[model samples]
Target: MENNTQTTIFGLRAIIEAIESGSTINKVYLQKGLRGDIFYQLDKLIKINKITTSMVPVEKLDRLSKNKNHQGAVAQISPIEFHDLEKLIEETTNQNTIPLFLLLDQISDVRNFGAIIRTAECTGVHGIIIQQNGSAPVNAETIKTSAGAAFKVPICKVNHIKDALFLLQAEGIKTVAATEKTEDSVYDIDLNQPLAIIMGSEHRGINPSVLKMVDYKAKLPLLGAIESLNVSVACGVLLYESVRQRL
Candidate 1:
């Protein structure tokens, strides 16, 4: 994610054009003390559309844009539309089949997210939930890693992971946190029920605050000298078990 060239749209007019083109602007960076009619319009548009924006010094913008004629703006352009979590749940539940979802807490690795999305699509998960910030940026690398699954899978970006879990729980879906803190193996869970699987970040497992709210904490058994599995593999394992059970 260092050189986010693929995801960035620079230049003030170009950024504004992106917004007008219905591009999902993840976040916008504006030069501090920047002033102009165009700038004002962009500000007004950002406020009207509720797009995320931050004021940064020109030096920072320059660094991010790699000395391009950015005209004091940089935006992260999203390639796909984010599904509404509530709406997704409603639609999935209305189908009368067991709803399976994947909730990612700080899953910052783009390739890993893509890989999980691929597996989720194969296992027929209803949707994937992630925090609006701190989640991996969907880019070419992610799409490549996913083998194009990123485009097919329903992705829901929420403000807070904990809040998403609460909503899921209230909707009669069991929140399962995959972490080693619990002795309950993934096999112990009844995946046939409405369920949401919580996968954590690469470096850290699920957030402690989120883990407390989860309905069940499940772990995949590790028998080898290694005690940990790649988050993507762990996700696939958790998902396939659900598939295995429902069959």
Candidate 2:
């Protein structure tokens, strides 16, 4: 599997230039204990822009940069541009159709994220909101897994999941979380209305704090021994329920 398809730019100055040029960076890999004037400048720029960074050994930097002179830092450029959550919400609300959105909390697997995006597109999801840090990067594998649906869907990256929830709630969109903690079945929820469905990470279900903020907590009826479904599969079920209700 192609793990990463993002273009890599090495050197601190080059990364700084890319940031200044408004390039969308997936993440930056920096060498451990690298202290220099240029590195400090790049670090400041990364923080100011709230770009994600990882401190790795020099070996990783070399591999990421194809054994080139990475200058103790390497940055990966995102393939697709991200959308603004507030602006996307406004646009969706202006349209004649009811707005349907998806919020993913810390979905770190690229393939799962890709599958969810494809399903979201099919279900007429207006947009997808994910946190900046724990979410999977949109790489070649993800796009391929999405069958090119990645380009069709508008995705937004926020500082925190709660930030997106607050904006959606303020706009009168009800938030629903998929979890086993609630007794309500997904079918019972009113999905025809403008709504945003939240799916938690693979291992851990929706964050407890996030569950408290949602307008509704629902779960799929599990008849078998398995207590939970895959995050992507559960998302499809919820989105299609919304589609069914609207029909």
Candidate 3:
């Protein structure tokens, strides 16, 4: 059944079918102590796909499934299809314009993620890449908060953000991470080249490992006493700077 921003399917068999059919599942809520041949099959599929799962009370599943017999499992399907990173890079590179992409390192808040998508669309970003596990799901709230820009932007889920960095670098795209750790300002960076800008999560800035891999580290100038900007706002400043440089 379709809910606000996600389509949910109950029953172990139904969820297994959904997985086999290539549905992008955001998460699966499993009732504790679920064990059966069908449940095992579903568990294996979820492991192979690395789909997030949560152990929830039966009452929660009851609520999610609207009191239907969920067979101890409920899957929330992603509202938007995800793109393949390598294919997207190849396609973007083939175009005449210089490729511009966004890599989000575990931005977990759905509203913040949606706002970033909205800004990315407005800034002409070719695609957005995020880690599969730690990032926010593109759910109903995200779509609504994005003002429908979630449907327009091509988003790719990677196993690890570093894997994406390697693939993008291999494709001749330079990466720039937005962080307060950098001495360089975003305005000083040359963003007209094929590039991907990395924005870290809200609490912790960019991961140190990711920082080591980036071609450049830059920060938005802070005139106030505040040490950092909100992830979405910082992201907007960085993206618009890229746009201004390219123009």
Candidate 4:
């Protein structure tokens, strides 16, 4: 997140003011089947602002609003602006350090994504790559979960993760996929160099097709009875291992 703007705004008047005040509204949710003068004004402003919007049920608005009196509409204001991957790479390459990147494979949990971003920022990761469609929305809950680190990290949303992986590969970045199927531990890989690690969703793990394209596949050692670690915790462990190695 790059700005000081609050992550959410509710109420039609407040939303209209947000638009008038030049706030960056990421997505707008309008209650389905609502029609009135105020609603009309908000809709007009939303259209004039060209904001991304969705017509959803009132229950959806209630969920997004956290049961607040939303008055049939809610808007999410993004605190961080998503970066262009190419430009971010160019800038990172110019920094003269081994660029560390994180590629999230279909992670839809907002808190998990935010936790990962917080860890990545703390560990000095250059940027994060997420799928444009399936990735979680960076909302107020995500911001709160990250402890505001979402504003500090650079993130890129790509149409397809493969294309971004190929681009990174062309840049000589070693793509590491974290999976439980691998015999290799995190210690086996030299993460000190420019590299990107693929951390996937808890249920599906990394995409098998993506698994085929990675340069290395590694996993965290599990000595206890638990079958798997939370994706956010696993991401932090991997990032810190790299951090330790680089230091």
Candidate 5:
């Protein structure tokens, strides 16, 4: 991703312009029940453009905008255009190296996303995979939270996470899901090989559809009553374990 590329669209007119320009928009937040010519125009444009739109409350928009007169709409544009799965696979294969990817299953926290990106880049993960729906929108907060790491990591957004996992399997990359249900810790896995790690959401663990697709399911060993670490922290632990194994 290009760090200098502007990716946020605020206000109704700007968002409309962004959509018409065919920018890779991650998602759109529209004020709930905002009916008018402007909104109808936007709805038409958004539908025709095939952009994902979410009807959010005014308070939600206000929180996202930091009260910056967002005018009831905001669009999260991709900092860099998302690459196709084939492109990512080809690039990895061309390098004659094992492909390493991090799959995020509905991680909604922007801070967690940022932290995970930071860890992923440092660990030499090839790419980060996220679902198009129910995932965090890559907006200004994400960029800020990532501390610019989002620009460094290659992020691929798929329509369905299961499809992405299937593609990874076809590419011969082992799909590993981090879950507390397993007795094995992430440290036990051999990350030196071509592999992808699935990190679940903070609230709900991994999705059922995703859990069923993983080649292996492992957990981080915890002796304390705390039970689990923060999702971002857990990501760091698991990713760094892969790094350690690779080294």
Candidate 6:
């Protein structure tokens, strides 16, 4: 991650906003299934909001905290501000932008996110969209992993990725998902067209909901022993192919 990226966000009000705003939070450490109105509200919100959570003992919270009465909870926020999908798309179109966009469905690794941003910037991707929850925070580690590319690229966080995809499709931009199950290599596809490439979490691949909505699902040819490439590397492969075709 980059040196300037934020690693910790404390205080009760800060934690509440991080949860409610759908920021890319890696995890929430609570004081071990705590019982109280505030704690209970946080817990209820955590479950209802679908934020990844961990109930840790007080000792663990102590280690994570500054030892200054943390009220049984702490939340970590990424340094970067998440972009809005519709706004980004609209801005590009209204500006007559020749756009290349990337959509990530639940990728949780900061390093991978950083790497992909580096690659996206290199390939001229207009922006990258990630789900606010279940995605990696743009912490110091992510910025460092991206080798400073995270700052150069625009990142958008959304509550539901399906709606984002639908909006893109409505704008005449082809939505493509990279999946191993497909027979077509990205090379076989036409990247010259205005397109949005979708990648999934390293473990799950693209979400089933997002995958079904894609205009086309393409896969990279696996000619070697390795079953697959890392999501970031796979993204580079697919994206550069688009760049190649466009050139």
All models: lDDT? 0.88, 0.92, 0.92, 0.88, 0.84, 0.81
TM-score for predicted model 5 compared with the true structure = 0.86
TM-score of each: 0.84, 0.96, 0.96, 0.78, 0.86, 0.87
In the range 1-247, model 4's lDDT, one tens digit per residue, is 4656457779899899988987667788999999999999999988776666889999999898999999999998877677889988888878979999999998989999889989999999999998765678777778889888888888887877897899898888899999998899999999999999999886899988999999999999999999999999999999999999999
Worst 10 residues of 2 by lDDT: 1-10
Candidate 6 per-residue C-alpha lDDT over 138-208 given as tens digits, one digit per residue, 9 for 90 to 100: 77788888888887788887787898888888888899899987888787787787799999999989888
User: Residue 30: error of model 1 in Å?
Assistant: 5.4
Pairwise lDDT winner, candidates 1 and 3:
3
Per-model root-mean-square deviation over C-alphas? 4.1, 2.6, 2.1, 4.4, 2.8, 2.9
| 99-213 per-residue lDDT for model 5 (tens digits) | 8899999999888888888888888888999887788867667777778878878888887789889888998889999999787777777878899999999999899878888
Tens digits of per-residue lDDT for model 2 on 1-247? 1233568799999999999999889899999999999999999999999999999999999998899999999998888889999999999999999999999999999999999999999999999999999889987778888888888899999999999999999999999999999899999999999899999999997888999899999999999998789889999999999999999
Model 6 poorest ten-residue lDDT run: 1-10
Question: CA shift at 220, candidate 4, in angstroms?
Answer: 1.3
Off by over 4 Å in 5: 5-14, 36-38, 48-52, 56-72
What does candidate 3's lDDT look like per residue over 135-186, in tens digits?
Answer: 8998889999999888888999999999999999999999999988878988
lDDT of 1 by residue, 20-45 (tens): 98777878999999999999989998
Residue pairs in collision within model 4: 1-80, 1-150, 1-151
Clashes by residue pair, model 5: none
Please give the TM-score that candidate 6 achieves against the real structure. Answer: 0.87
